[model samples]
Target chain A: MDLTTIVILALTGVLLLLSVIKDRRKTLAALRVAYKGFVRLLPSILAIILVVGLIIGFVPPKWIAQVIGKNSGALGVAIASLLGAVLFIPVIIAFPLARSMLDMGAGIMATAAFITTLTMVGFVFLPLEIKELGKRFAVARNALSFLAAVAIAVVIGVIIR
Target chain B: MNEKADAVANGKKRSMRERIRWDYTILFLLIPAFVALVVVFPDKGATARHVAWEYFKEMAMILPAVFIIMGLVSVWVEREFIVRFLGEGSGVKGVVLSFILGSIPMGPLYVAFPLAAVLLKKGAKVANIIIFLSAWACIKLPAELMEFQFLGWKFTLVRYLATLVVVVALSEVIGRVFFKQGYEVPDEALDGAEG
Candidate 1:
């Protein structure tokens, strides 16, 4: 496993250890809650995975690049951010796809915007987010996040270039 | 609402079988759709499985720990504590605390959703929770490291600083405009999944 996995595993182990030591009963209750909660959230989680698979399988990366790469100014940034907001591709995959775009003449700002929005604004998780945190909070966070992605891209563009 | 609380307190609530049927239905429908996609495009189907499998392995490894910690929050953490630390009057310290709480975890954004929900229920500020979710989503330490390795330090650092500034501003605007009245987690919305 990677560092993230190892670090989180260690932390969770310690927390579980402490809880068991301090109060076994409460810890058991906590485990029960964990179990029930996992079951409750399992469905949407799987749906997201399936959807991600489908998108990756169907939508060619070359096509996505052509949408943003075909332009270089505001239109490029806007298209990049919009695509980022909609796509559910994982960050690991996103990085390589981004590198390919850069090699093919995509601007740094557009790439930055795409990555930021893809990470920050998850359209795939909207239903789950809304269910857990309310419609207003979910909608507001996403809508603002879209704008923020472009703003950050502009800042980075100005600074880097 | 009181009865639900009582059910939780008693730890004897009935199985949430009915409430979860929608999820099962979605899963049922998705399986066939995916199968059809795979059958139509065999080569792309392999790529799809490869992408999904990588993430599935990551989820399988981390989710139990993440869920356990979430459960611990439900049982061990007090609502008053969340309020005092992350609520409206918490100031700059609240934002810092939210960032710390968010960055230390290792999971996809979706995993954080339930935790954020729990914190929201317990009285964390909407701004603070948004900050937490934002950090979890993008500014994660490992994520930045990955960026550095793939895109180089110059690109990584510039984008990192930019994202941090924008995340804070975005979260605050969302907080002020939408949750100015203090958003409440409606009881039925979080019905079966309090943990």
Candidate 2:
């Protein structure tokens, strides 16, 4: 396993041990919860993986670079931000997809914008957000996040590039 | 009274089951579509499958552990504990705590919504709750590690620092503009909201 995976596994192992020691019953309950959550999340996770595979397999790197490459400029950032907002890919898969995009010559700014908006603004969850947090809070947070995402992308583009 | 409560609980359970069924349906449909793509364009399909397999392997390595950690957090971290530290009058300390709490990898952002709502109902400051939600969404520790692995240190660090600052500032702005009169969370509004 890679260093990240190893670290995570080790951390989980140690924590599990400690938790079990502290309270075996609670630890068992935690494991059950974990199993249930994994089962629930499995389909979406698999779908996302397949989607990423398809993108890499079918979509030419040249085309991706053309759309979001260094020369794509402000328009590219906006497109990336919009895609990030609309798409529902989990953050774990998003990083790998983004890495592939960068390797294919996608611009740093565009990638950053995509990642930022992907996480911060969830179009699919908008109604739920509004229901829970109220329309005003939800609307303001999302709108501002979209704006902030673009701005952050521009700033990162300047600094890194 | 007991019968009414039981009916409401059963209704909630049914809806939850329905949602899971819909998710499975979408997954099943996508699988065939993917297989069809492979049939149509053998070479590209193979490549896609290969890439998908690589990602699947990577995710399989850590996702279970991540979920277990989440489950632990859910069971261990008391709602009252979250409220006591992040509630009203928490001030700067509350904001910092919120960010730290949020940065810990637990679950998906949707799972955080109800928790945020609970904090709101318990009188957590608007800015802090916003920061908590934003951090939970964008800057979780596991996500950052993945970002670092894929994007490298400079990119990861810059984006993390930049997002942190922006989220905090944005949260303050959102709080001021939307909750100028003190945020009032409606009781019972989050009844059907899934965590």
Candidate 3:
């Protein structure tokens, strides 16, 4: 791990210890709240994680490279955006994934869209979103993000394509 | 009037499942994650183990920190402070602040999600948090610097500019439309308007 991350981890540990030692009741309350939240979300998250595993199990990087790689145009941009709209992979994985896509010849525009939408949009998280934030906000945020993804992709496509 | 009423009635007739099936949020979130897993991680045993282990360690080390920080940020920070600094009325200043705050984020995107959730609960506007998290994931300062070393200044600048535009535009849209009734333009959000 990097120095920053290590530092943050150490701080977290210290804080947790302090919280536990100082106000055991509050600490326990917080732990309970956090655990309850985790339990509520667990089923859906686990299902999503399984689906993620399946995706990794099947699709090859070459296929992604073929669709969005260096020679791509409007179609490639659309495919990349669509792909992004459907996924919610962690940001940690996205960098190496994008790099590998680049290595396989994915165009910069497509890569940009893929990364942008991957984070912005939350298709599978909709249920959780609805449960947490309500339907209107969930719909609007996601819908706007989808359009924004396309617009961003096109803007990048124009500049780099 | 009849058509509108009919439309409302027709909509109400559908099951939550059916309505949810049409929810784009679910689909959009799933695809990129799916693509990442499919397109990124090696399928073979040894390579998969190496990649998984590395990522596992990184997440293992980072997640606890993320949870604690997120909790602290939520509990310690006041909603008014976040709104004044990054809320809608903060305008250009707010947007710039949000971008800077987002860009410096060091942990993973998932880490930001919980933080964003806490911020929302604490009264940070959805628009700002959306912009913050999205930008945090894409245009990380340290990560971008690393990329600059490999990808050149021109590419990085172009990407950064594009991302800024996208983040601002999308955040505004989300703020305007896609939120629940109670949270939509919360009364506290207007308190920052004059500032």
The numbered model that scores best in lDDT is 1
Per-residue accuracy of model 1 over A27-137 as CA lDDT, tens digit each: 988888788767667787788788888888788899888777777688888889989999977777788778777777788899889998999898988977876677888
lDDT of 3 by residue, A1-161 (tens): 68768777787778778777877766665555444444444444444544554544455556666667755567777888888877666655666677777778777778877877887776855665554444665677677777777787777667764
Every candidate's TM-score, chain A alone: 0.89, 0.60, 0.74
For each candidate, what TM-score against the reference? 0.88, 0.68, 0.70
In angstroms, give how far residue B153 of model 1 lies from its true place. Answer: 3.1
Give candidate 1's whole-model lDDT: 0.82
Candidates' C-alpha lDDT: 0.82, 0.76, 0.64
Error of 2 at A37 (Å): 2.4
Superposed model 3: Cα runs more than 4 Å off: A1-5, A17-28, A87-107, A122-135, B1-61, B87-89, B179-195
Q: What's the best-to-worst order under lDDT?
A: 1, 2, 3
Q: On a 0 to 100 scale, what is the lDDT of residue B56 in model 3? A: 53
Tens-digit lDDT track of model 1 for B128-165? 99889988888777667778878889988888777777
Candidate no. 1 TM-score: 0.88
DockQ of the two-chain complex in candidate 1: 0.64
Tens-place lDDT per residue, model 3, B92-156, is: 78777777777775675555655566666666677777777677767776777755665557666
Worst 10 residues of 2 chain B by lDDT: B186-195
Error of 3 at B123 (Å): 1.7
